[model samples]
Target: MPASRCGAIRRADASENIWCMTEPSAWRRARAFSRGPESTGHRLTRRRRARMRRLAWVLLAGAALPLHAQNPVEVDAQHYRLEYEDKQVRVLRFRLAPGEKSPQHEHAARITVVVSGSRLRIEDTDGAIYEMTIYSGHAERQPATRHTVENVGSTVYEELTTEFKDAASQPPKLVVKAPPPPPPPPKKEEPKKAEAKKKEEKPKEEKPSVAASAPTTPGAQPAGTKPAATGTTTPTPAQAPAAKVQPEVAAAAPPPEPQPIIKPLKVRPPEEPNRRRRKSFAAEEMSEATVNNTRLAFMEQGKGQTVVFVHGAMGDYRTWQLQIPEFAKRFRVVAYSRRYHYPNPSTGKEEDYTYEANVRDLAEFLKALNAGPVHLVGHGYGAAVATLLAERHPEMVRSLVVSEPGFDKLLDEKRAYRSHWARDEIYNIIRKPLSRQNPENGVRVYHNWLAETQPWQQIDPQEQYERMQNANALRAQTVDPTAPAFNCEAAKKIKTPTLVVAGQNRSPNSAEITGTLAACLANSERVTISEAGPAAYLDNAKEYNDAVLSFLGKH
Candidate 1:
């Protein structure tokens, strides 16, 4: 038989053996041979047919499998185990023994927390190789990748990885190009052209029939009538009568006046009722004031009497975000991020990161604002600053609100000694982590201690992120020896209508310090906010705010 009669057969260039039969004749012949008798030739044909059918099914099954099934866990089950999975994220526990190598696998963008130290070699599909030494308890974020990992160290390499599914996981290859210009507007037709179009569209009139000219009786056929056919053919354009041409008087009409372009007005969306949009505290929203050649960032709102808020260590103007709107409703509120805090350039010198320097800055800041005798509020380290400022520059302060001031120097000899010993112990605990270049762990320990909480992991993630922004400042403060000492004498001099606020559940040290300061002040009253910790304002903002507002209203 010729090739056309038999149809064509082609071999596919695939890993799997695939035969393509182009016509129904080839399929019919194969099916017939398979169903034929068990002779030598028949058996051979039947066996070949069965093999092709099996191959076809195998190909379809492979195609049906999901692409994501080729992830690390499924590719190398021995090295990777699925720990947790949800729509937003997938967590996996991975472990590779000494001298062990894993098959090439893919991973989404993930954060890996190392559980054991190891030296490893990684090879990517693109032929690039990387060697790294990772430490136990170290964590880092990695872009989505496909690679083979081999542990070359003497111990097992183990890590817990959380892969993000919500965000773009793959590493980006950026290209810069100018945007394409917009398309031009459509052309409008002129009045003369529009008039000529109308004239061409006029319908033609038909000639009168001969039967109609010779009037016929009712229901009677005319002399020239013919029987009705299935259909009638109209005259072609060449056979049709010529159309009449109109005079040029219509085209002589003047064009109408140009119409004005009407533009749409933009209307703003209505804001949600009873909901105040919180400030983002972005760079643009911040106002800068230079005090003694040092630029400080602050946020101000409202009017009337001024109330200045100074944040402590590990915080910025954003710390008072909860209080700013509430206070601004009644008084002029100004909250500033102290020196060496987040979003501000720092000298990184330990000596400059002291409470005394902060006090000097506050004094100058008040003078620059010229908001005479303003209400002052401070927390933690900032509380000490406010106290020192009031004592030194009495004219600058109207009323003072100090919430659990960390001024150990105001304590008597025995209490001061105990405070120093506790401080040394804390430094000892954080020293190793800082030396290991993991400041987060150090900050965690310090934060837990100050918050009087056992575990730092329970803290809000947003708060943690904001606090980490000032990790450098925390490090500087940790090592600084020039921290200001505010004694009883200094506290006695600050008779600026002081309101010392303390948390009901505050640590013993904080209670003692706050009590001592309150006793030292000649004209001062003390109040405690219940269900709070060292940071009374943050822990119980409503009660703290009400207490402070009541005190401010009195003065």
Candidate 2:
């Protein structure tokens, strides 16, 4: 009970005791004196104060009462039944008797009925008013309303409310304020003349290149390899001799047909350096260095050229389950979950998982397993990771196959739709429960996160749970909104033969961003995988596998 009301009740109790203790005849005899009416006035004042206290007590008691009380007059009876504890609604009934009124309150949603006996008038807090003469069996939808119900009749009134009390219990909610749609992607501008000036300032023939010194063909020798001696005479084969004296031979030799010069075919060497190999999975070999802190759990299979698969956010090596068996037939395939993914305990530190850190981890992992100069294949965020890896460790990557990196650039390009998606997607899913102020709702946020991404749709419920655990660990490492425009310059410096694939009809922004990245690269091209999405690998394993294999080739 409210403290003020409790105090009032105590005062009323004391007053009642005092009245009870006084002998009734004595009290009545004292009340008979009107001369010097001061005592009589004091007695009247005391009675008024006691009555006021009793009224306050009743109001407070009603407010404090549990909603489950059988008394319909209890302030929250219907609200508590609908909002908290679940109850099924069969038929809702409301009854009002003569000369009674309802306390003022707001109704949030439409309900099925308002019935009244005798004449009644409802005045809303907003000054809107309605009058109704209710009878025994009448039923109708209540207005989206806020009001006080009053009885115009001569007797006390009663009210009954019926509603659908049992809504399926929903998980606690979160309120993810949809991020403002990113600004429209900047329009592409043609390279300026100043760009050429910058280009000219730098010396040409930069970096180590075998092609600069070595002969173009395997059998051709470098310029310095053949010594040029002064006045050296070389013997010529005896003149093909007069063998042409015959008429047909004479015609053939008429003018030694001018020899056609054949230029050597120049082939560029692999962009990355070769590294040592580890035992294959079919042989049941395990690397000494673990992917996380645990023993290696990845399967390394087949043996020709090497292809390392990196899974995306909320994914594990199993995401490559279908691709592994197929790709492994023609190439060494190795897939592993990074730390905090699966079979790995999350370190839960943002420092442990920057974009740079992820790339570095892949580098170390490759080194530990004696696998490098690898053809790296990545999906979604994994593509971003792979691109960074190739940029930083160019010597370790032979070629790269990246698909739908899920860069924020996509949302930035399609700002309008992204904004709507964020609101509709996150409001109903993440923000509502959060507005209710419950921390148990964090899990709902994670689930909503998975729902936002396309890949999660293909995963099973058990897999979803496991993936959520990792996402939770990494959630702290959100992209810095103002971080410098993506490090495309860094990525462009990579010379690996890179194939960028985007899924058509998935995320238009994804495709656009993929095109932008490919355009920015020194040796990259983009392709759209028809009818595919973020997890196209799983959606059409054969097609995806074939594309990767074709791009990588035997080398």
Candidate 3:
């Protein structure tokens, strides 16, 4: 709690308060009215009243002095735990009542002021003493001390303590008086040593019945022995909490192979019109074959070799919003939103969202439209889809440029991988529902994960939060399907030229995985995009676009 003096002035109205002084110095006249010459019947001179008032001011100032002069904290009077000295020292104050023994304890250096009463018995390993009539206002100082206190007083006792150093503030040569050093710690007696001592002390006093008595050493009593009345011997920890006999439980036969426990797949109903309006941006002239039964909205205008840009998960063609104009000038660019996204509705089932299904869909769309051997560029989750497509249909992929595909190489089947997979799997399952249940708490967890991952940190706060929401929502819609459906193994079999670019700010897992993917491919290159994150294409658009253009031209 802040000191009362540090608080702002009260806004309370003072009109009804006759004793209220408008300012700190107004106590003078108020005091004069209360005290005046007993014989003076008429109104006194203003100067005389002022003189009397001045005296009142002096007294009031004295009474208020303590509030401003010293910082005193009233720690609990019962348990001595306290914080004082402006967070410098922790003070603990306790009082032992009559016939009461304080628990064996220790103090780090302290000074005590005796308030009243005595017959205080302070005990140590050496001996104990009873001090009589320890007067009030007496201060006792102890340094590096350990002892137990007992109060023999009939009435309540009190004490005030102020702690200070055990040594004086001067050089050893100039120092005069200092408390004697505390006694050394007692040597420890090992259990073996104690057992040897016991054997020596009771050489021939042994008896066969001693085993029965042995269990009950000093205070322990066996059956038929009188029960102790005071300070009962607590049974040895092993003897206490006696184990009770429990009825035998027969082991049940193993469950009958769980009956295969196949869960019926829950078919998702067709999405609403609003949900189906998928949007895609294309920067090339579209052929008639491209306008098929698919709910794909595309805008195209450009020239040169066809370059189709695939956006990632929970993303529309808008991801290439910045690249369309630049790439259209050189390459025939086409950006298309995936099914089930805005402006276009998907006719296919939930399987369409799977990596294979997505890649297949893009391949079919490209083939139908006669978009052959087109250079492909994708970002983040989209990069994963692009990799699968390139792997599966190597002939169709002229060259591939994927930026920051989130694949973990270290996350193979192992303790570390299993733990991460479990966490991510649980996160995938519960994130959406949990976030919807409590947004603030959900965002907190998201940001905590974000703080650990560089890609997340590179994103703006608003974007990061939105990404979390979108990811959670996407997870909600597409329940747990499968783990890593992308054919990384097929990547090695791919004969198409490949370019894998990763952001430096992101965890190296992406680049490392990409490196592995590139090594698997017949012709592949691994590159790093500096000052970029997971969405490197967007974070550093021009640099990334140029890199892609250059890679494709060379390939």
Report lDDT (Cα) of residue 249, candidate 1: 19
List, residue by residue over 424-493, the lDDT tens digit for candidate 2.
Answer: 4333443333233232243334333333234333434334333444442334334221111354566578
On TM-score, who's better, 1 or 3? 1
Each model's backbone clash number: 0, 19, 19
Residue 289, candidate 1: alpha-carbon lDDT: 53
Model 1 lDDT tens row, 101-133: 898787778899987656688977666678887
| Candidate 2 segments exceeding 4 Å error | 1-297, 347-351, 409-459, 469-472, 476-487
Q: What's model 1's overall lDDT?
A: 0.65
**Candidate numbers, best TM-score first, in rank order:** 1, 2, 3
Q: How much is the lDDT of residue 541 in candidate 3?
A: 73
Regions more than 4 Å wrong, model 1: 1-284, 347-351, 428-438, 452-454, 481-483
Candidates 2 and 3, the one with greater lDDT:
2
Question: Of 1 and 2, which scores higher on lDDT?
Answer: 1
Q: What is candidate 3's local distance difference test score?
A: 0.49
The TM-score of predicted model 3 comes to: 0.43
Number of the predicted model whose lDDT against the real structure is largest? 1
Candidate 1 Cα RMSD after full superposition onto the native fold (Å): 32.4
